[model samples]
Target: MEALKDYLPHSVEGKNILITGGTTGIGRATALLLARLGANVMITGLDEQHLKDALKDLYKEAKGEVYDVIADLSTEEGVNATFRTADSHFDKLDILINNAALPAGKVENGSYSEWQRVINTNLLAYTACTAQALERMKGDGHIVNIGSMSADVREETGSIYVATKSGIQGFSEALRKEVNKSGIKVTLIEPGAVDTDMQDQPTQEKKEKVENLEMLTADDIAISVLYCLSQPKRCDVVELKVRPHLQII
Candidate 1:
């Protein structure tokens, strides 16, 4: 057992981690797992009730400290407030997970305000959060951006979403090169057909899809995140593309 432990040298225990859009879906799942592993976690969400609820659940399973803040990442002020909460709670940040996002919609059908909200939440917030995280990190940190496979698929339905995700794909690649010299690792996880609130399907239908392997559960993506964090510092899992076995998209 001792020798087998050498396979993964890094550990999340005692590390300080901040996750954006963490009240529901993948972000919540990731926070729960990290908290269980003894990492101090700070989660940001837009809803006050949702934040309270998520914090209650997180505290139940967490070994290290758990905190939550109300944040609307679509605006600049919200992003600043979120990190200020992080600064007050944690002494330093070891990991940053950019997971907050809005649902997809066609660019042509939506109002300008709608498109702006989506862009700011999905793409711009990730970049802004990275900048804030970088300031707090003292070398040897990790940043995980939760992107989507829609970037590559480029389907007809959600052109705006595809744009932001595609931007993330390029942004992650470039950011990795920029941050690597500073000993900070950047990873992009692009998931396909995840059964989360983002999907408008009925609850039962989504459950059936997951059962049939047509869709992935939020927990599945959380496990992938844990895998990336547990690797040795010398190894950087740059990009991870995860899809369900039967998911065509």
Candidate 2:
């Protein structure tokens, strides 16, 4: 097991970071890791109670400023509110982790409204947030998009989810080419199934399969984020894919 201290470093010290959906899963794990490493981090989530609880955990090890805002990233107002709140906390943004996403089970099984919600949350919000971050980042910044292997290894009943992940893969690539000249680095992290609350709603049999498969933990993805941030400004990790050794496709 890799300890949190092992991931800490002076490279990210005093850097201002903003992570969406930071109350849980990869976002929360990354927030905690960066906070421990001496970066001033502001995280946004939709749940107030979750935000409070995540803050409690963050305060325990955060060496730099830790702030959070409760805001939905699906709506324009929510997106604006998040950046407004972040701006008040930090003068300049060094990193933007677009980790907020909604998983959709099936295309045919869901209604149009449900489809819209999933697309807005998973795809549109990421681009909108990136645009906002680019404005605030000036000429130098790092944008890490948390994508999924589902984009490539598609499965039946996962059409909607796969569509969004696929969009992220393409978006990250095009955006990277557009921004790299400005000294901004863009990274896309595609990971196989991870053990998180996101998996709690699956069927018992499905959950059993995941448990047996030895899924990647939230910290595993966080370490990937840290690795991207730790690189020197002259170097950029364009895309990183991770999967549990036992995970098939």
Candidate 3:
């Protein structure tokens, strides 16, 4: 007569969590939900105004502490600054959600600087953040990486983006194995066609697509992230691929 709840061993309450690109989209939704669940949430963003705006909303429902840092994750100095700020506020780390990213064009369409920006922001930042988090996470922390379906689909005219996503997919797999023995769990949550700022569509158009089940909301992916985090230590929800029911690709 063992209930399903008996197997759910993890609880986010009081855990210190760090989320990047949390000013909007999936990262914002995840931060808000976790804050309401009584977790100490720290969010980062590139824009100071955006960081302030997100913190304003997070504190509205937050039961535990909530903090924000404004940093450009594409650079090494920025990554170091993010962790330094986190250390000042939180004594230790419990969860790291690598959700920061950007949209990109084809390799030939953009300049070398643009390509570097995309790669640094979308791919290298995840690895850099994980390294910093691993130092703070003694043995039993969770690292949730927000990859994309682009890794699998590899759509045309999106070679630059595909490259970064593909890198993340491989990075997450290797990271999981490397951290497995340390009791650290790594979960890769890949979402498809989410109606976020990254989407090149009007808000109403995006809503219509969502209503038609052709696209998903940020909250949809947030719930998936929460599910992966709430699993028992013995049960790792390794890779979760979330797509809208009617999304063609």
Write down the lDDT that model 2 would get.
0.90
Candidate 1 vs. truth: CA RMSD?
Answer: 1.6
Task: For candidate 2, write residues 140-234 as lDDT tens digits.
Answer: 89999999998899888789999999999999999999999998899999998787777655656545655676577799899999998887777
Query: For residues 77-171, could you state the per-residue lDDT of candidate 1 as single tens digits?
Result: 99999999999998889999999999868877889988999999999999999999999999889999999999899988999999999999999
TM, every model: 0.97, 0.92, 0.97
Candidate 3 TM-score versus the reference: 0.97
User: How well does candidate 1 match the true structure in TM-score terms?
Assistant: 0.97
- Of candidates 2 and 1, the better by TM-score: 1
Query: Which ranges in model 3 have alpha carbons more than 4 Å from their true place?
Result: 1-10
Q: Weakest 10 consecutive residues, lDDT, candidate 2?
A: 1-10
Model 3, position 52: C-alpha lDDT score: 85
Mark the regions of model 2 whose C-alpha exceeds 4 Å error after superposition.
1-8, 201-213
Across 1-249, the per-residue lDDT of candidate 3 in tens digits comes to 456664322378889999999999999999999988889999999988878888989989899999888999999999999999999999889999999999997877989998998899999999999999999999889999999999999998799999999999999999999999999999999999999999989999999999999999999998898899988788899999999999766
Alpha carbon lDDT of each predicted model: 0.92, 0.90, 0.93
RMSD in order of candidates = 1.6, 3.5, 1.5
